[model samples]
Target: MLTEVKNQIKVVFLSIKYSVMRELLNRFTFISNVIFMMLNNASMIIQWLVLFSLRENMGGYTFKEVLLLWGIASSTFGFSRFFFYKAFSLSSIINEGKLDSYIVQPKNILISIITSDISVSALGDLLYGYIMLVFYGLSIKSFLLFTYFIITGGIIIAAISVILNSLSFWFGNTDVIAETGNHLMTNFATYPDGIFKGIAKALLFTLIPVGISNYIPVHVIVNFDLNLFLINTTVCIFLIYFAFITFYTGLKRYSSSNLMSSKI
Candidate 1:
C-alpha cells in the first residue's frame, strides 16, 4: 500500500512537470496569459480599496481580513487550476467521451484526466495570491498557515468540480449544470461570507461549500479556532474521498468515444 501511494505521488508530479514543459515551449503566450490574468485579479482589489475608504468594514470584515479573503480565494483557485485544470472541464470531457485515453493508462483515471493540462493564467493567480499575502504582512506562521489553507481549499474546490461534473455519466450532458455550479462557487468565494444570512449562509457551508473553501479559512486566519480548523480539515478529507468515489463509480458507466488522440 505504501509503495502504491508513493508511485501515485510520483505519477502526479511527473504529469504536472510535463504539462509545465509543454506550456513553457510557447514562452510568449504563456507569459502574456499569466500577466493578463494577474492584472485582472489585481483589478478587483481597487474596488475593495474604494469601498473600505468609504466604510470601515464589509460584513464585519475589516480591510485586512478582506485582503486575506482575496488571497485565499485566488490561491485556492490557482492551486486547483494549476494542478488539475481538467477538473473544470470534466463535463465536456465526459460528454465528448474523452476518457478513452485515460482508461488506457495505468495511473488513476481521475488523476490522469485532471492533470492532463496546465493553465498558464493560473500561475498569475498564484502570484497574485502571494502579492496579497505580502500586503497582509508576511510572517512565518501566517505564511505556513496560509499555505495549509490553500491546499485544503484547493482540494475541496477540485473535489466539488469532480462531483458536479460526474453527473454527466447519468444525465448524458451535464455541462450546463457543472459550469453554473462552478461559477457560483467561485463567485461566492470572493465575497464576505458574513454578508450572507440564514438559508443562503447554510447553503454556503453545506451544499455549495464556498465557506469551507474561503470564509472559514479567512476566519481561522484572522482569529484561530481549533474546532473550526479541525472541521475544515475533516471536510476537505471527506470531500476528496467523496470525489474519488463518485468519479470512479460513474466511470463504470462511461461510454468511450473511441477517437484516436495522444495522451499528452
Candidate 2:
C-alpha cells in the first residue's frame, strides 16, 4: 500500500516536471504570462483601495485583512492551476472519450490526469500571494498558517473541479455545469464574505463552498481559531475523497471512442 502511494507521488511529480519543461521551451512567453497575471491581480487592489478610502472597513474586513483575503484566494487559485489544471478538462476528456489512455495506466487515474498539465501564469498568482502576505504582516506563526490554508484551499479547489467535471461521466455533455462551477469558485473567492447575505452566504458555505476555501481561511489567518481550522480541514478531506469516489464510480459507465460506431 505504501509503495503504491509512493509510486503515485513520483508519477505526479514527474508529470508536473515534464509539463514545466515543455512550457519553458518558450521562455519569453512563460515569463510574460506570469508577469502579466501578477500585474492583473495587482490592478484589482485598486478597487479595494478606492472603497477603503471611503470607509474604514468593507464587509467587516479592514484593508489589511482584505489584502490577505485576496492573497489566500489567489494562492489557492494559483496552486490549483499550476498543479491540477487538467482537472478542469475532465468534462472534455470524458465526453470525447479520451480517458481510456489513463485507465490503462498503473497510476491513480484521477491524479494522473489532473497533474499532467501546468499553467505558467498561475506561478505569478502564487508568488503574488506571498507578496500580499508580506504586506499583511510577516510572522513565524502567520507564515505557517498562511501556507497551510494555501495548500488546503488549493486542494479544495481542485477537488471541487473534479467533482463538477466528473458529472460528465453520467450526464452526457455537462460542459455548461462544469463551466459555471469553475466561474463560481473563482469569482466568489476573491470577495470578503461579510458582503454575501442570506442565500449567497448559505451557498458559499454549502453548495458553492468559497466559505471553506477562502473566507474561513482568511478569518483563521487573521486570528487563529481551532474549530474553524478543523472544520475546513474536514471539508477538504471529504471533497477530495468524494471527488475520487464519484469519478471512478462514474467511470464504470463510460463509453470509449473505440466503442463508437459510424451511424452511416
| Top-lDDT candidate index | 2
TM-scores, in order shown? 0.96, 0.96
Residue 240, model 2: Cα distance from true site in angstroms: 0.7
Candidate 1 lDDT (Cα, whole model)? 0.89
Which tens-of-lDDT digit does each residue in 145-234 have in candidate 1?
899999999889889999999999989888788888888889998899879999999999999999988998888877889988998999
Q: How many pairs of residues collide in each model?
A: 0, 0
lDDT, candidate 2, at 262: 30
Off by over 4 Å in 2: 259-264
Score candidate 2 by lDDT.
Answer: 0.91
Best model per TM-score: 1
Global Cα RMSD, each model: 1.2, 3.3
Q: What TM-score does candidate 1 get on C-alpha atoms?
A: 0.96
